[model samples]
Target: MPEPATRIRPMGRRAVLTGGAAAILAAAGFTPAQAATGRSAGKATGEPTYTLTVMGTTDLHGNVFNWDYFGDKEFDDTQHDDIGLAKIATLVDAVRAERGRRNTLLIDAGDTIQGTPLAYYYARVEPITKQRIHPMAAAMNAIGFDAAALGNHEFNYGIPLLRTFEKQLDFPLLGANAVDQRTGQPAFAPYTVRTVRFEGARPLKVGILGLTNPGIAIWDKANVEGQMTFPGLVEQARVFVPRLRRAGADIVVVSAHSGADTSSSYGDALPYPENASTLLAEEVPGIDAVLVGHAHAEIPQRFVTNKETGAQVLLTEPSYWGRRLSLIDLDVRWSGRQGWQVVAKRSQVLKSNTVPEDTEIVALLKGDHDKVVTYVNSPVGTSKEAMSAATARYEDVPALDFVNFVQAKAVKDALAGTADAELPVLSIAAPFNRDAAIPAGQVSVRDVAGLYIYDNTLLAVRFTGAQLKDYLELSATYFKQVTGSGPFAPDDVTNAPTPTAPSGTPDYNYDVVSGLDAPLTYDIDITKAPGQRITGLAYGGAPVGADQVFALAVNNYRQSGGGNFPHVSTAEVIYNRQVEIRQLLIDWVSAAGEIDPVAFSSVDWRLVADGTPVVIEG
Candidate 1:
């Protein structure tokens, strides 16, 4: 969960792995001397047939309780409605039941510890007691996660909390790439080998090596920036493969918290596009298959060449947010002399169709689920005006502005007594869930929760006017600049955005900056380099130099330079303070009793040069 520098280019993307991955097919636990003589543990007498099924859930993002921020209600799908530890537990049981005991193993890739209001509420007010585990972890433990890995967001609560949670884990948390800062040894169990025997007396040893995306520095800087270091994922793989082999693993599987993009295949098999999950497959030797996540994309099956060893690679990813689950069925063999290798493999999706949620796991988590419901569904306040996110119908709706105003207030409050307490506080916010806009009229508890779905914490950092420009330029890359016309097509309904252009306006620059006197603008061409993305800059009302700094309040992800933004990563100072923005709004509005649309206005977006110019919409 750490990265090398400010560059968005993944240091792990090209990390090199070593050794012959093909050895799996020949020597999977078979003696190398025996394999050389064309003999395996049973090859001499008979062909050893073994089938292993791997069940994986990735990017649950703390959906342990059945609450939904989007619906402002319990997520009701079918069996008791919506996905939660209960439902996933049910689903996991059906999978194992269908597969039987000897043939199955269940694992989660990452983001298991953070992302819901329950986690938010628990972390802040309720002091941890051995009697009461964080509901999410408790549910996961009840559901019985066999092995799990760290996601970048897991570090949000900082290591102390994680270390506490770690004590309660029923299974090993495997991470091969993450090393201890003190000795560069694996911080957690680098990889775990579990033996499962579908048939016969002695079980086959299955090796699982977990690798989280090395973007930890980007999202968890507040809690984990300097405590540890991360090696290039590829480099770590090379070192670990040899160690895993020496450890007597029969079959090797990787649970990668990274993701895949639509990249072209290189020669035999290219690591499945844009995703290190696929890349991890090809690059690491002796790995039979990969369970992938972090992109939130749904991938059926992608075949790629091991970039490091030129061995074949297989990968699978179910979408994020509990939308899907990926299952891999693989045949493996072990040669006495060589090691373990893949014989055949396939992937299946964990959809509602034909799959019923497990009844038992659901029962185990219901108590925790009900507790969350009691709090989340309680009507703390009400609004008379109807609210919606239909952006096309209107711009800068009341609910939108309300979120910003409340967040700014929290930031200001959190910084009390600090030098920045009175400094011109700039609050940065983005609408993850938006539409036409929040309508004017009676608002329920569900209304506010629906608009802000992500369980994100508020963060503030000190940035220079120069660093601020660099950060803004990075955000600007999200917008697409229209050539002869404005940045956006007024009638373009799909929200489809152009990636790059002769003008090179990125369509993703969606930010709300609060409390600024003079408006601001960036005149530089984005087609230029990173440092030069800003051709011109302004403050309160004047041209600003690069050397100046400002106190910037942003979400945990942005403050860490997530989304490949520049300058945020290189800031000279970080306060390391965190405020749960979503809950703060919930808290603020609940305390306010009534809401007003008049409070939300922005000093963020400045005037443009194009006639009736449009900005690329995100």
Candidate 2:
């Protein structure tokens, strides 16, 4: 079956309607002048009713297929099997077919680009700027997206690349809260107007206002610090919702790249909250529905009532990586007094694996996929011995040591001539992917990429001895307390499955400290409380003093307070660049000629339960 056609009319020169009675007129094939004059042939007039289905997808981190290029296999997480845009395409078609094509609107809530090997290959290896179209733009265009909001990760590669990406998209990339530093005007269009015409009912004008997380200011400060400013999500929505209503929108939908968490990171210290979907829905007046993202969570539906007006606002979030599709169904009736009001509403989260992968999307990007597969398969270096992260959570592994070596070397090179060059340096890292392994012999780009799966840049920060000890203690909390002498299971040390109240520690939060010599090795006792888990910490054959100072090699995410690590974000930064750690690994491996596991590897940390050996079975 052919894809449904979508029409998105920009509100260019329509008469500004400020009063409650004033309505914006928009329909297919209607010009701005005709809409403003209210003379369009199919304009909404008398009492009429209709249904509108709003479909949303968010946090599609460049998973175009079910294939995992790094692992060279189909994507599977063991628990839930569905993933990628090809799966999402099937659901989109089904929903559009069930509802009238003209009444269904598709929207995306950001984090669209820059995650998988496919996206990274296009962005770094073969830039999309040189190519005609980005794979993301091509896929989204083929799927007929009406509008999209911006996410914080979108600014990681810099504004030039983001501009190139925006130009290739068929839909409007809206970020109403992202304002220019000098002009204070929206850098991107604040909102988009979609005019829907039912068979015999009045035209329904839906306005989509886009709001992104304000953490972009801190996370991507290098790229967007002075160029653009991000205000609070609720603050921006308050300003645009009224304007959208004034412009004749009967229903307003907010495409918020912020998550549904109501907690405020700034806590009155700053006006902008990092995650504020719940707050926005409760505070904003004119919004009918909100599409939330950026936390990578699944929330089918949540209704928040405005305190003053007592009006209900519906919110929905589809899980990340195109695993699910969020649908919001609205039944509206035309009232002579209020124009159009939603009388009934329903929502559902559809699984992406319910349908087959869209062959059209797979065929459209075949050349790009093949190029990435070749690039990741090509050998870059040789490993003298096999390395694996299987036991990394319980003890140190060579895979993590290799990463630390690269990070420390990069920091040393970056601070070569700086004042802090002579300071003692310690590098910290975590095993991101537990299943990652490297066999002895030729090592390909895929092996290295799998080891460091995240897109994190290197950073050098100054930390006092006390802060370093605190950091290690925080890392030790990943292990659960063992009451009696018994064989410990692997899952016991793992964090609580609930993300908000994680128990022990996550593999990503387990820090392995390098640059410490013999006699300085430390052990973690899981029987103690979280803050007192670290024992016998020493450096250079002596106990680490609280007043001692050291330079730490870390990632941008940790340095920016991503996991709520202690004192790292406030530390004095000495070196930072746009370079990614994975790329550095590739460069370091290529320059070293050969990697002998014994040269830079060390077993400096281990997990023990009350002076007893803890068996780690992998």
Candidate 3:
């Protein structure tokens, strides 16, 4: 018996294979050795081909070490125990060693400076706007990144910090679509061209264009309102791609900080798509490959054929948080007519745990990491009992009510002297993280940060009673359709449209109300369709009138129509504050010195299926 044929995927190989030849090689029992010996038999060749390797990292989110500051330990999700730039630096070194360092290039697809507590500590607690080199900048510089794209989260801390962080980087930060409001020209370097030669042959020019997400305009409206404008990805690609080719670039690659999906959750909210990487590759011409991110999805390799030219564009997106590295290898040779053209290509996403973390990175950022550790561990308040958010999605728990109480009280206090004070107020809260909890003994800043992971501000919007009912109905869609009321696993109650979502509905979408009075109770029937799930929605012991108006307390993300909530963005704003909800919670707890469940915690909602009340385990 003959040994099984090896997969012909290219890995730092200089040999060029036509699409037809690669497919026929295995079936014809032809080996790579035979191809090398009989190279001249196929066609006339003038020069030898060269192999070019491109590596990429995205959504690093300020994670330099493999440590999770929230848990104060090495990052782990039970199944996959890997994260951060230390692991990526190790992988980059291995790839550079395998494929000559001169022939390799490294790039990051943004979202580098704002996810963990470490990032927050640097940006807010210790302002990096000064001359100090940002941790992300220092780490990326150590890894030798050639270029990067701007992610939407990059604007969360405003442009001054972003610009300061950019000045410290050795490479050009690319963002073709991030434009200036006054001039409408690219605010940052739109593209960068790097020239390199392999085997001391003729130099090849590689042009890289970076495109950011359009959702930045909505998400970071306050920070970038009059300073920066974000245009569509496809629009900017059409303009820059031609310029790149005219600039004599042999290979044109795009490092798009956008997702692979073309669909926008905020339909018609923005003129362009928020996640338009697939569209850019399919519509634009002369792009050889694309590195996608900002969606945190794992796409090892995808090939999209251009509609007009029928040319193939290779794409790869490694998983977020430095867990994986997206690698693309292209074999280019001097085509007598077309000059240097890519004859063959291959791509893969390498896991971070396969290699050990680089020790140099751990040593370089140890001081900053230690400071962040001290910042998070500092006590904020005390908790009477251990409050866990694990059951927030399954039951009416005090863990979420605690947040709702703070938000509602803040809004009422702000609207004290205004006409909106007389209106009924309902505060909305979501269980952002399932693992969020406060120990029985004490509560720290990290505990509150874990509970409200995002940097969202508070907003009090005025809504009609009909719109309020619509909001609850939309949230009711989180529950899965059920039949029998018998005991069943809560984990098995997920009914998301896609399988990739978290089980038992996403905690971010399971919102709870905090100000409804008695006999105004409502029950969600898991057995019914989404729109009809919420039954017996009432106010003041009667069915809520459509004309009745009220003030709804919610975060800015939802007020900007996040989570696809109904009529949120269209509602009139009665009160708006720059105060972050997390900060408010910390202040409220600190002033009281302890959490009192009797102050706000109560059960006003329940679940029913088949006319039988459903009981869930706590």
Candidate 4:
């Protein structure tokens, strides 16, 4: 196993806090209590209070620069937010300067490796395991991170690559819950204790316990099924936080890759809730603050009181893609008998857009950025007409059809001369990016990649007609119920709130199913309730029989219990080539040399209310 690079060592009483010395002691066979006493301490003079600021970023998703590879331009949004570590470096420098460099600690929550084309290029095209340092590791090492929590997406490229990325970092990737399957012991370092020095008072020990989401068991089942298991965040924190306290930590802060909400996307597939950062705060007694992640929502500050201890725990989550940075400030007072105790705590999110890109980071990553830009812009094929997925959430469009077409074709081709070859193939796709579009004339890799944003692989499963109907019914819940249609807007009828998605169902969860060789048509009756919304289901102009079995082409995420979709997870998998769906689309376009949607496009589904076709304006 690779050792964590962030482990600090003791260098007398006036030693500066550079690494995880307590972890080094533990590695040297010292017990938790022994490690606590191993730290050098100074004689306390008076009750002096000091402020410690913890700066945090989460869900960076492979952004090193503000440029978007898919769009071939600098990233911009409705809020004019800036992205990437280059901009975050500027904000970090400003914070370190204002707070004094020695008093502040820099950390991250998770999702560091996979998102943009730069990450994909490194992970797949030229793997970092082949002796090349990952750009994320290089940039983060340059910025000097103390530690980071493990995210569920860290397993996207499998374990070997993850270990390589971990070794290249200057910080430890902490995960108390990610344990070995057989031993039931933590596979990674549970927590790290850092000593913050003071002149006249005793040094403050800050314990950072890293907790990862339990959904990794479901989302990355293929990569870690037999090797490891992920327990709940609250469950593992209960075991580690007390140990951290016993390790003589003056203050305990949790950097969790889970969200502040108590919702699970996988719905009972695992015994634990997916987003349990608040539960960790409310249930765990010793924690003083929490850095939340995974939900990608902005929360300046939230205080959850512990039910048993009556102490308030602070929580904050910076938005994803390095757009925001979380600033958590804690005040601690030193005493003769009791040592150090936290007096007050608060947190807020700082916008990276308010600052300029740090020239140091920009210059360091310029070569890697330019390589990805060139790769994505390289022409793959030509298109006969333009296609857009702006309104694909509520309407049938060729952009999504093109995705299903390529996926179903690939599955069918893979199953040729096999037992599943005779079965009819159906494909399912989701509108991942609302702004994804394919322009007329020559097409590039970025055009196809934008259509399928996730790093999902394709798989084929056998499902009965009844199970297929149930799947469609579950997907139909994405739309809100309506009476007589008066040309309602798409937004007014789409993204209905569900138990899993209390803040409206995301576009990725609203799947659109289509037939490969024939037209499979149906109507989602918005007038009806969920489970009864899917009506007029037919394949090849005839009603689908409940016992009819067909091969369904689906993504690995959906097949592996992502979004809690019905029937698919338990279905019998017929084909599993482990092929990435995005690469398939790009390869198909490259071989064909033209993207003429007329060859495979067909309107297979529509929205209706009381047997009347619903008109969706805009």
Q: Which portions of model 2 miss their true places by more than 4 Å?
A: 1-48, 264-271, 496-505, 516-520
Indicate the worst ten consecutive residues by lDDT in candidate 2: 21-30
List TM-scores for all candidates, in order.
Answer: 0.77, 0.89, 0.90, 0.93
lDDT of 3: 0.79
Residue 511, candidate 3: C-alpha displacement in angstroms: 2.2
Candidate number achieving the greatest TM-score relative to the actual structure: 4
**Candidate 3 ranges beyond 4 A from true positions:** 1-46, 498-505, 516-520, 539-542
Consecutive 10-residue window with the lowest summed lDDT within model 3? 1-10
Q: Which wins on lDDT, candidate 2 or candidate 3?
A: 3
In lDDT terms, which candidate is top? Answer: 4
Q: 389 in model 3: Cα distance from truth in Å? A: 0.6
lDDT (Cα, tens digit) per residue for candidate 2, span 229-329: 99999888888899888888888999999988765433343467788998998888888899999978888778888776898888899989998888787
- The clash count for each model shown is 83, 4, 0, 4
Q: Return the clash pairs for model 3, or none.
A: none
Candidate 1 residue lDDT tens string, 1-618: 332111111111111112222232122121222112112355543556455777788888767645564455646555432555555554555445444545777778887777765665566556345676877677767666668877766777778877777777777776776677777777777777776654553456777778775666455656665676555556677777677666666777788887765231111121222246655666667777788877767786777787657766678887765656576777666556644456667776565322334455456666766665666656657665666555511144455556666765666676679777765556665556643234355454445666676656776677677667656665444433334433544433222243322222222235545443233444533334334445446666577766655566677766555544555545544454466666677777778877765445543353233423235355
Residue 119 lDDT (model 1): 63
lDDT of each: 0.58, 0.78, 0.79, 0.85
